[model samples]
Structures are given as structure tokens and as C-alpha cells.
Target: MPTTHLTPTTVITGFLGSGKTTLLNALLRHPALEDTAVLVNEFGDVGIDHLLVDELDDEAIVLLNAGCLCCTIRNDLVGALSDLRTRRARGEIPPFRRVVIETTGLADPAPILHTLLSHEALTDDFRVDGIVTTVDGLHGERQLDQNIESVKQAAVADRIVLTKTDLAGDTTTLRERLRAINTTASVLEAVSGDIEPAKLLDTGLFNLHDKPPEVTEWLRAVDQDGWSPDNGHHHRHDDGIASFYLEASQPLAIHRFVTWIERLLETEGERVLRLKGVLDVEGSDAPIVVHGVQHVFHPLTQLSRWPDESRRSQIVLIGRELDEHAVRSSFDAAVVG
Candidate 1:
């Protein structure tokens, strides 16, 4: 796949008490971030955090009063992005090139990314540069061991920011443990939410040229063979937590593909934690990438170029109590039929 450079939008996601708000507040104060737009989602009955943030420029901050970005209120997110584009066109908001979405502490970022990447109205205007996950340095090790969402956030991020290092008894040990889970992500330290803004932005999906050898090796590991149902490497949180993959070499029959996906949602909606993948469909010039969490699915998106030369369809699934073999078999049956 040839490289296509687009203006990057970064997402900051982590568990509650991960200092996401603190990091945003600090970033907003940076001189380099003068022209950036910040989208904040606060999950609560009454939204008060919007008032806490000091918006330097007029209309620079848009707060989604809705509780979570992954819920039905996600339409509000689409509206907010649309509004941002309108304001930019009318010169109402600052002419910003970067967008930063801060998900609620308990929020899962996969759905939000799906929205940003798959929204028809928004994709033409913005691209996901990368995901920056903030892990509490003090509690990160324990959190990764216990919290399934936290682990997913770490696994999918292009960059991981370790916050509260000043309080963490052993930053070195925590960092090592994070590396074990996700060795490809660049790990940076933050003290009191203070870190260089440039480091957190623009780390795109695939870093082919300048990445370390280890990172390249890790990227290769993303192939279908890397994740097999026979392997005991499945994610285990509750019976409600699972992670698996789906792969297809032949292009999917578009109509059948739609039916298959819809049926999955109808049958196992609640248990579907996160689903993302690149699909090769007949009649499409490029691969269609889809993302969803729980019942909400952003519109399917087509990348200008494949992330790599591997044109085969490959998807990663995160669900709870969902049988990996059954899901894969069902998808295969649909394609064959």
C-alpha cells in the first residue's frame, strides 16, 4: 500500500484516574497547541468539566455533554465534528489542523476511533494519526493485569504515555511490564501532565521507514497466523471478555457481508466489545475498514491505500464470552454461501 499523508487526529484514552483530563488541560496550555481543537467527553449526569477547561481561543473547545462516546449519544460526536468543520469554514473557530478527542475515563476508544475513521461526513476532513493511551504509572501494571479495557487501550495504541511517574514507586518496572504487553508502542513519561505535545501526535497506523527493527517485527506479528483459536492466548477477564480475529483471502460478497455483520449484532450485541478490520469486498477499489463496539457501528470506511501489501481480509475482534471458533466458522459459512 502506498503511503497517503493526511492531517492527523489524535485520541487520548485510558481508564478512570488515568489523568486524561489533566493531560488535556496541560496540552491546552502549550504554545504549540495554540491552533488545536479539543473535543472532550465527560460521562456523568451533569457535565461540569467543560467549565474547568480554559478555552484560549473562541470555539476551540467542544464538549459532548453525553455520558459516553460509545453510546447512542455518539450522534452528538458526529454533530460536533460537523460543527467544527462549519466553524472552520466560517472563520468562527480557530483554523486548526489537529483534533484531539478526550474520552471519558471509563470509555473505550475503539468506538470513538470508528466514528472518526468511518463517518462519511468526517472522514474526508480528518484522519486518525494515532491513538495515545495514558497509563497511570503507579497503578498501570496492576490495571493491565485486572482491567480488560485498559489492556485493549494499550494493545492498540501507537504511543503510550506513562503519567504520574513522580508518584509511581518504580517507573522502570512498570515501563518494562507495559513493553511486555505492547512492545511496539513508543513509551514516554509525563510528570503532572506535562509532556511535549509533538510526541503524542502524528504516530500513524504503520511506521515502515523509520521504525525500530523490533517495531517492524511486531507489525509482522499482526498477520492472521499470529492469532489462532488453538492458541491459548485469548484475553480472559470475565466470561464477558474475549479477543479474536477473522480473516478471508477472497473478496466478500457485499450483500452477504452486510447480512452476516447485522446478524452478529442481533445475536450477540452486548457481548461485542470491539471489532475492527480491513475487508476486501467485490466492487470496491480499496479495502473497507469497519469498527464497532457493543451495538454501535460507525459507517464502513475505505482507505485510499491498503496499510500493507497483504490484501487479504483481516479483522480483530474483542468480545465477552464469544466463541472464537464459532464466530470464525459463521463468517466463513456466510462467505461460502
Candidate 2:
């Protein structure tokens, strides 16, 4: 199945008191997120509560709450999504183009990603847009140093939204720390929860209207050339989690590439918080993009055409205590094969 046209889902996660709700509340009021569906652990979570919820459908779900679809997540997220789909088909709720799930403050986030990307029933209709993490400028540094979950949340994000900059002076050190945790992620500040929704969305490869996936933007950090096997500079966070990348100028044999990915995931999948890249498979005319969260990798997405003239295979990997040389050597073996 093609990735295009699937309702992109964004997971918003952060530590307690990190302003996930504050940012979400401001985003809910924004017109850009008006057509979006928001899922939270409980309605009691007041992330979007500031908005006026107009209508309520029976069965304890808030439909189009805050001028958008808002629902409380039960024990299983799958059931909630299924119910929403059913209601949409029955015209019970307004049609939505995207979805945002707000995770609890202490979440690891890998399990949620696996569910969204690999769940059999949900994959056909929903695709993961990206993970947006909120970090409190005042407490982000302390959280990262003291809490492993907070570090993980920041480590795997596609975008890190730093809140309370207005109150916290000189977040430069905090920003640097975040970049150290995940160099590939875009670090943005949401002072008083003011941010452009566009900066946070569209972080995934797929797009709406069945359009071509934005392969380039999905891996834009590759353009920065951040990682190297010999930089002698390592960015290490809690549990030795770090960001790195491997690239090949020439096309790689599909079999070898697949084998490397299998071995890598089989051994280091849990450590691999996120892995995404564009591969120039030897026998293919267009590039194939691969995205994975932990052990679950999405189906290979071969684009209609390359996003740009750059045909090099670029892979960005975020994991715990990853050995750069070993990964480079293993990748070289695959490419040389």
C-alpha cells in the first residue's frame, strides 16, 4: 500500500510540567490544526481544555472538541482509532486530515510508534507523521540529566518544542543539550506556546491528497552532514544514546542492504530509537525510503521519482551506545556486497 493519503499521526510527548498541554492548547486554536484529530490519555488532561468544546457525542467521546476532533484514549489506542474511523464513515464526526496523540509525561514513545506504524488494522488508514516533544526550558536540562524517559522523549523526536523560554533566561545551553541528544531533530522554542503549526507538521515522508512523499524534508538533517565515523566528537545523552548517519555514493544491492537492516535491528533494534533514510537500491530507478521505530520498520516506500538530484543513499540512525565504526563497517560490507 502507498503511504500517500494516509492520515498522518503525530505523537506529542514530554516530561511532566514540560508544557505538552500548553503547546497543544495553542495548536488546537490554530486554524492549521482545525482539521486534525487529537487523542489524549484522558479528558482530564487539560492540554486542550482551554478551548470551548461545543458538541459531545454520547459514549463518552468528545467529537470535534475545540473546533477539531478530540477524544479520550481508553486502555487500547487501537479501539479509539477504530471508533473514530467508524464514526467518520457514518458521518458522525467531522472528517479530519491529521491526528495528534498526546502521550503521558513519562512515556518511552517507542511502543506508541510501533502501534501506529505496524498495527495491521490501523496502518491502511493511518501513517505516522512524526513525534513532537515539548521540553520545559526551565527544567529541560535537569529532566534530561535526571530522567531517562525525558531523555528518550527528546532523543526520538522529529521536532523538539522548548517551552517557557520567556521565563527561563538564556536557553542556549538547553538547546545545545537537546541538539546533543538528537542532532537530526529541529529544536524550536514555543515561548508562551506560540509556534507555527507548519514548523511541527509535515515531518514525515508521506503527505495528504496522495501526493508524492517529501523524501528530502523527511531526511533534511542529512544535508547538514552532522555525523561521521571519524569526527572524534560524540554526542552522548542518557544511556549513551546518540545520533549518527551512514551514506554511500553508489547504489547498494537490495539483498545486502536488507540483510544489514535485519541484522542491525535484530541486535540493536531496541537501542535504535529511530532510523530513516533514502536508499538508492542498485536495480531500482528511483530511491526507496525506509523508516523504522525500534524493531518495526515500515514497508519500503519507492518514490515516484527522486526528491532531488542527490541520489546518494543517506541513512540517519538514533540509538543507545551505538558504535560508529562498527556500524560504518557493517554498512560498508552491505554496500561493497
Candidate 3:
């Protein structure tokens, strides 16, 4: 589809001391990442992270200082992005196809997501490919148990990477805890964010090809009756984490679908951690994949090829206190007659 032409930008985030910077440094050296630009956010006035990268002739790196890029520092983000475009136009920075944003350790990624989703000019120029969150395997369990922001970070991740796995005392327990919080997120291991860079990027929402067979099967396993509160298989934890599937057998009316999504944002915006799905619109032959963080929704990009023969609309939602029954009811009610 024409929409597939849009280049994907990956946002890498994690709580403080989660090894995000280590991952970015490692990724910068990857041969495949030659045509990539790295955007870094430093929590203080001194920006030394940018100086740490060993610059190659093919890559470009820029750092945003001090303020978090989401709110107080958003204007800086806009200016930097604009500067990147200008440099690309003037042939200064390498002709990069991908952009990576690395937020500070304490940053709440939702605001950064908002800038990418709600900014008019930025949306036209870039598409959110996916969000990759690094969790400190040793401390992640404790963080999730005690920290609300940490819970939010894990909930919104497209890929949850367990960093510093070598130091984690009980890897299995940590993995189990993460799964309980967000069952649909792909969990990966990274000694020092040293895994293959290709695996970390470009896994757009509903890109079944990138998912393990079990995940693909999980998404396709949605019940025909639609999501309901009584489903015994659905899981939840005390920290407001819940997982459920939503499916539509028939192609959805575009306007109705949009309206239902808006209603979702209005009702449980803050609690919604992450949502991803493939929708077969009523009139469009190609499938559109939707991705969102909290209330911020990325532009739906149509796929060039159906990942497989299955064309049914399916979505996986992971959130805090998300009411599956209410969400399903609203969607069903919004269906065009």
C-alpha cells in the first residue's frame, strides 16, 4: 500500500538506570543503522552522551539538554527535528531513513508520544514505528511493585527488553512479573542492549512477521463473541494491569471506528498503556495498523501486504484498570447499521 512508504521511527525509553544509553551506543555502531539519526535527552544542562558516541561518516547524532522532551522541553524537540530536516535538505546529516529518540531515565514517555502523535508538522514528517522499553531485570520487579511511572512505562512498550540480565538474580521471576503486567508485549533479553539492532526496530503494530508464533496465535485467537468481562482467561494484577483481546469479524466503518477510538481516549486515556491492532476498513482493501500510548494515537499506516491470509481485524490491549466489557460494548454500539 502507499502508506507503507512512510519511514518508521523508533522511540527507546526506560526508567532511570535501565541501560537505554547503553543500547543507543551499541545501536549506533550497527552496520544496518548507518542511515539513522540519534536524538538523545539529557536530564541536566551538561550533555555528554552525544560526545560519547564514536561518530561514523554515515550516522548523525543530536542531544537535547536538561528538560524532559515531553513538556517543558518540547519546543527544543520541535526545533531539533526542524534542524534535522534542514540539514538533510542541505546534505549535512547523512540521508537517514530512521530516527531514534532516547528519552531521559526519569522521563514519562507519554508526553514525548504526544508530541509525535499530536504535532501537526511532525506527524506529516515522521511515523512512530514502535516503542522499545528497556527494563533493568534486577530492579524491574521492585520498580513495578512500588513505582507508578515504572508501571506505565512497561504497559506502553511494544517490546519489553530485559537489560542487565546477567546481574538479575532470578530472571524467570522477573519475566513472569513483566508478563503479568503486559502479556502482549514481546519480551527480549539483552546483556547490555547488545542484541541484533534489526530485531529492535520496525516491528509496527500488527506486524505479525516480527512476532513469535505464539504471539501471532494469541492475537488471532480472539473470541467471535467479542471481549466480555466474564472471560475466565483474561488476566489482571493488583497494580491495575490487565490484558484482553478485541476483534471484529467484519470490516469497520472508518468514521465509526474513529469515533469509538475517541471514546476510548475520553474514558480511560491515562490508564491505557498500549494498544495495537490491524483493522480492515469497510472500503479499503489494504489493512491499517493502529498503535497508541495512553490517549495519543499514531497515524494508521496501511500495510503493503497483508502479513498473512487472515484479514480479520484484531487488537491486543494492555492497560491499568481498563474495562474490557465497556470497551467492547462501546465499539459494538458504534458499529454502523
Candidate 4:
């Protein structure tokens, strides 16, 4: 069950003044996020900044800080992840079931996601479980307008935590802007970065034991059999990013669909921000779930059975300036054969 049971690694990122730190601190304290290794820029928090005693074995990775284990990213995320795995296997450090990485405010999340998905040392043992972006509800709209990085962060998010919403009066415009960028992402409000850890976990297909209903909703556009926005938002995307689903009722040849995905990623990976779906493969009774970011993808999750009676396959793509007709025609060609 190694393939099915890989450790979930969620990247938490947002722009300056976006409440990312507040959210990270909140999430790290929760019992739900326990047994996790948190990688941060600096051990800035009081209880977590203490140095480990050499008698503990090595000073490279620290543990028992706060409730969960801790490691300093310090600018080397790949090194941190690789080191954690090796140390965990050797019993040099406390075992952690999952990982949570907090990116710098100005950093782009794609590189961390790419490393999680494609890095040789970590790919097999870890999977890109989710991307949670904390947005400053009061000023999120301004940040999105002024910062391309903020736009991309929100565009590719799985769960958008709108922090300080209680104080930000009338957030209708901000929500609409977010909806336009990523219609599929679930938008949750957090007052002073107060949000449940359970809402953010399992954004991808992992640790989904007996949660069929939730997983089914995760696969976008349940009622539609054709192209549509996952959320009920209908607006032209002036920012050049769009999210749409391609659906088919009949089972698809897994090989063909996968081949198309590979070529798509190879050719236009940078433009493709996120890809997710639940598929009814030709030979399989159970549904196969797909999740990816940029050029890399998670090992497909083959469920025990269809989440619901809806065996239809729907592939959701969120990207910039995607050629909808060409993509759909190509999908049709794959299905036709």
C-alpha cells in the first residue's frame, strides 16, 4: 500500500499581509495537523525556535517542537524534505505522518510544488496533497491586482482561506475576483486566520477512508456532462486565467487519456496551473483520480469503487489562455478511438 499510502505534503503560501503566518501557526497547533513536520522560513515562534540537544542524535532536524515536529526551510526546501525522509527512516528523528511547508510571502509556490511532485528523493514517499493560500480579505483584491505572484497563488489554490473577513466589509468583489481566477477552489472565511485544519487537509486524493461523498464533490462538475465552471460563477476572465471541465459519460481508454495529459504538460505545462479529475477508465470498475501541478502529477489514485453512481469522467484544467476548442477536440479524438 506504499503507493496508496504516501505521505501528504501541503504547501501553505500567500502574499505579504495575507495572514499566511497566522494560518500556519493556527494549523500547526491543531490536533488534526499533529504527527506532521512543519517546514518554515525561520523558527521565529518562541517555543519552536529552541535548538536541539546533541544527545538527541543530530542537530539537522528538530522535533517535539510545539505539538508536531519542526524543520527550518531557511531557503532550502528540497534539502529539508530529503533530509527529513532519511532521518525519519534511520530513527534519528521522530516519525512524522505528513508535512506542511510555509512559503515566503513573495515566493512563487510552483517551484515547491514541482519539487514535491518530481524530486527523486521525495516523490515515492511523499505526494502533493494540497495548496492552501491565505488571502487578506480586506486587501486581497488590491494584492491580486498589484501582484502577479498573488494572482498565481490564488489561481492554483485548492482551498482559499480568506482571513480577516469579519472586519473586511462587503467582500463581494473580492470573492468574485477569486472566483474568476479559480472557480473550482473552495473559498473559506477565517477571522484572524481562524479556520479548521480538517477543511484544508485531503484537498487531493489521499487518506480518504470512508469519505466518498466529500471525494465526489472534490471531482468538479458532478451534474454536468460537458464544459462548465466547477463553481457557479459565470464571468469573463480578464486576467487571462480560466478553469473549465471536460466531461464524457462513457468510459475512456486510460492510456490515451494519460498520453494526452503528458503531451499537454510537456508542451504547455507552464500555462497549465492545476489539473484534477475522477475518471471512469475503460477496464476498471473503480474510478481513477488524477491530480497534478504544472509539469508533474501525483501517482493516480484508484478508488475502491465509484464515489457515487455517476461513473462519468470529468477532467478539470485551470490555466492561462488555454485553447478550449483544441483541447476539447483532442479529448474527443481520444474518446472516439
Candidate 5:
């Protein structure tokens, strides 16, 4: 009578030549992604070896040797997504549990994300798992400075993958630049598109069946030195775009917190590239996790216990041209007022 499964979707984005397709190609071959449906900007860009993949129909849908489905977003992403659902419904396609949308290097991810958030049909059937942004280690710093699009890509990432590390020739500077832009996202090192798929996907709520390894990784990001609200180092940088951490030792009043977030998003949604937190909500022994990209908020997750020893409310806000002092003050005002 009703759908028992909700598809988890991940958006793989990066600037031109960031190795997005290379990463996707590697992911498709992994056994972990066998049930994944991949939507790419162009079929030729991925360059799936003809011997390994077989075309399913004239519509350019192909089934990979590993049992994954690959298709191109011809024009309308909404139409393509709807088609996938319809085909899955009628038994015309594989039962894909996950969907990965790989955007072109030149693309801005916000509109693509907005589609997922505002589209009623897609929202009802799927959930925003997380965003995985690939960064070109060799040229990322220059790109970040020259291209505002590149900056936006790095700002909104849930996981930042550093590609071409072998050729980058000491990426400490690039890595630091990325971290300065986004502290909450885990930056993974990758050489030639090789990485554990499990680390990239399944970043949502914990599941006994499929425990995500990034839970600990995310916790570690928050527990880093000098990120606490009272610390002078609460904000990571002053480069127009920066990340700041807010911690409340006391449990948050759920209603007040939600109202505060909604009000803030309504006004500053465009500036808030990313927001994530592990909250200590009043009257709840469990920890509540909240994630937001721009104006869209994911469904909150309530974990049974603290992932680690620190049980205080921890929130990481990453934004562009944001006023950290005012934000910190507002956070305090919202929590109490």
C-alpha cells in the first residue's frame, strides 16, 4: 500500500577537470555501488568501456557490468528522475537503492540541489543523503581564487575529495585553503579516483544494517582544537568565506531551536552554504542531528546515544561573507530568547 524504501541521493560536483567522472567511474565498478543509478551530464564524459557496459534501450540507459545503471541528463533532470522512478515502478529497471547525480565541472550545485528540495515528487520518494565535492589538488587553490563557482562548490560540500594528489606536488596549501572554506566537510585524499565508496555514501542517519564510517569522521571535525563558541579561534578564517563552530553546554529547547533555524534560513539561506550540528535537545536522551544546504533542511535524525564523549550541542556553520560576530551573538540570543 505504501513505499517502504526511501532512496538516498548523493550529488557529486566539482569544477572543470576535478576528476568527478573519474571518481564516478571508479565508484560504478565497486561492488558496493552495484545497486546505484548514476545520472551524469554526458554519457561520453564518463567513457564507460563498451565491453563492460550494455545499452538497455534507445534512451541511452546502460547497465554496467557491476549491475549499476548509467544514464545521461539530456536536458530536464526532473524528467529524467521521474522516468527512472516510473521505470523502477513497472519493473523496467533495476531496483536501485541509491542515486548519484554527477554534475558537470562548470555547473553550480545550488540549483540542482534546489530541485531535489523543492520537487514534491522527488522529495516524497527520496532523501538528500549528502553532497560529495571533488577538488583538484593540483589547481584547487588557483581555482578557488579565480572562479566563484569553484568557491561555491567547495563551500557546499558535505565531503571534499582531493583528486590528483600525486601530481599536486605538496597539497598542504590547497588542503588548508579548502579547510578554511569548509571545516565541517571531511577532506579525503584520492589518487586516480580510488576511494572507499562506503566512506562517501550512507552519510545520513545511522543504520544498524549499514553503519556509516563517517560518523566518527564528522565528530572528529567538530572536536578539533579552538572551535568552541567561547574560543577566539571559533571562526576558521576571514577570507570572505569562513566556517565557525557554536557549542552550547546546555541542552537546546527543540521548538526554539527549530524556530530559530527557520527564521535564519528564511533571511540568510543564500549565504548559509552549509549547516550541520549534533544537538542536545531538551527532554531527549538521544542526540539529534541536523543538516542543511542553503535553505533546504534534511529530516532530523535522533541517535540513541552520543557518538562520542562530548555530549554538548555542537553546530558548524559554513557561509560566504557571513558576519561571524553577529552570527555568534544571534546564536546566543536564539538559544536563550
Candidate 6:
């Protein structure tokens, strides 16, 4: 039998001390993240958050007492990924179907994404499925205002996990800030790095087993041509952050769609933040789903058919200081011309 599916990789990122390890530990304890290989910044470099992480080998490949396998990056990401693939293929390591990468708090996600999606050796077997960013509910506002990295993390997330909610603080303010920053990304609250692993991973257009897609859940927070900055500010956090949706009821021309995206990335890649859309193409029955993190674009995935009865194209954009009018106008021109 042929290889049925490419392994999906999800990047778990957040500001410093945002409970990424805690979340990873909680996810490991459960069966959901089992058989999932994790590439962390370091192993045994810091104390484990929730469970005891025992070193299983000298190569810095450790195992959680709960059976999750993890390895530390030795300043070579491409080498690590290639080595992991080789080990799994040769039956030396567990055949993990999914991989999770935890980036350092101060790290920008765009470069890592560029390597994963654009690298020649990695693209054939691994595909980036989603990015899960964690925000400190108590200090998220200050972080957003002070740190550009924090803002970028939230801007490009597929799911924004709000951690430290049980601590003493008001999360209402943080939630509003995140919404203004990334209206399309799902914001899930975690009590103590604990969340439903299934809900947090494989959040792209399709699952690993190639089952019917979850289109509604993927686009839940976004509305059709809804919530513009010009329509009057509903939240205080909307100062420079904007969230909006664009939809085309009819199928769009393929060339126009590609050109529109290319142009957007070329001119305003830094401000583009996170973009995701499932488009109904003119001649193809399948829907083309595209995702981008800033300037880096993930390989487009075409689904077999529409997940639901509706066949309209919907796109959501989250950006910092983004011009809502220009984006909409350009999209209109693309579809019309």
C-alpha cells in the first residue's frame, strides 16, 4: 500500500512563560497527543511543568512518563526533521502521525513557517496544518502593547489558547484584545494548560484520515462581510487591530484568486497577519483552501468536495493597522476582472 497521508505539523507558540510546556504536558497525559512527536526548544533545559519528563536516550530524545516522545532541537531544525523521518521510516522510532513544534517565546513564527513549508526535503512528507498560539490572559494586553512578537503570534494563530485564567486577573479585557487582533482564530481558554487536544490540533481544512472537513467550526468566529472598523468601534482594543470577512457567493476564477493573493502578500505581507479562505473555483467541484502567516504561505490543499451544502467562497483576514477598504476593493476587482 502507498503512503496514505502526509504527517501534519502544528506549532505551539506563545510569549515567554505562557504555559506552552504545561499545555504540552497536559496534552501528553491524555491519549490525544500520544504517538505525536514533539520538537521542543530544549529538553531537560528547564523543569517540566505538569509531569515528570524522563530522559529516555542520550540524543536528548525524552519520553513523558505518560508515553509522549519529545526531542530537543540542537540548532538544526531541518536536520532534526529529516532525521526523525528517517528513524520513523526505518522503524527506529515511533511512527508518529503528527508533529508539534514549540517555539521560544521571543521567536517570530514566520521564519519557522518558511522553513517548514518551503524546504525541499521536508515538504514532500510533512505539511503545516495549524499554529496554536497561547496568550497570557492577565498580561496579554501589556504584551500586545509592548511586544511586537506577542502581537504577531496572536495575529497568525489558528487557535489562540488563553492560559492563566484561573489566576487572579480579569480575562475579559484580554479576550477583547485577542478578538480585535485575530477575529478569525478561535480563542479557547485553558485553566492550567489543559484543553481538549482534538479541538486544538488538525484545525485546517481536513483531518489526517481524510474525513469530511469541519468548515463551520473552522470559520465560526468570522461573519460574512461583517465587523468592519469603519462600522464604529465596538471594543476598546480595536484601536489598531482589525478583523473582517469577505465572501463571494459565486465561484471565482482561479487565476484571479491566485493573483489577488500574490499581490496581497507582495505589497502588504507584514500587515496581512493571518489569512485563511476556502474558495469555490469556477470549474472545479473541489474547494481550494489557502492559509498564510504573514509573508509565508502554506501549501494549498484541495478538498474533495464542499463540506456542507452551501458552495460560497469565504475569506477572513486579521491584521494590524490594515486598510479594510483597500482590501475589500482589491478583492472586488479581482473577482470582477
In order, what lDDT does every prediction score? 0.68, 0.65, 0.68, 0.63, 0.65, 0.64
Clashes of 3: 1
* Candidate 2: tens digits of C-alpha lDDT, residues 35-58: 777676522112222111222212
lDDT of 5 at 199: 86
The sequence of per-residue lDDT tens digits that candidate 5 reaches over residues 144-224 is 886666876787678899987886689998888888777777999878679999889888832212213433343344344
lDDT of 4 by residue, 1-337 (tens): 3556688888788864466655765666677876677765421122211111111223333332211111123225555677888888999777888887766455545444444655567777889888888887766886687666787678668888998777678898999888887777789988745788889997764332322233333333222322121222121223575656678888888888888888888888767655667788888887776755556654676645553476788776766688878878887886645
Q: Worst ten-residue run, lDDT, model 5?
A: 63-72
Between candidates 1 and 4, the lDDT winner: 1
Position 334, candidate 1: lDDT: 89
Worst 10 residues of 1 by lDDT: 228-237
Q: Whose lDDT is higher: candidate 3's or candidate 4's?
A: 3
The root-mean-square deviation over C-alpha atoms between each candidate and the true structure, in angstroms, is 18.1, 20.8, 20.6, 20.8, 21.1, 20.9
- In candidate 1, what are the lDDT values of residues 1-337, reduced to their tens digit? 4235344688888865576766876788887777788888865444434443543443687888645775545677788888988888899766887788887655555456556655677777778777788998766776677666787677667888898777667788878877876777889888767988888865665333433354334334433223321332222225555456577888888778778888887787666755666778898868776655455454675655554476777766666688778888999898744
Q: What is the C-alpha RMSD, rounded to one decimal, of candidate 2? A: 20.8
Question: Backbone clashes in each candidate structure, one number apiece?
Answer: 2, 0, 1, 0, 0, 0
- The candidate, 3 or 4, that scores higher on TM-score is 3
What are the per-residue Cα lDDT tens digits for candidate 6 across 1-337? 2324778888888865566765775786777766777776522223222111221222334322211111113125666778889998998886788887776555555445555655577878888888889987655776688667687778768889998777637788789888877777889989766789888977763221221123332222222323222332121222564556788898999888888888898888777655666778888887776655455554566755565588878776767788989999999987755
lDDT string for model 3 (1-337, tens) is: 3446555778888865577766776787788787888888865444444433444332377778855664367667777777887788799766778788888655666556656654666766777788888998766776677555576667667889998777666789888877876677889988856989878887773243443344333333433323222332232124465556677888888778877787787778777665666788888887776755566565676655454477777766667688889887777788633
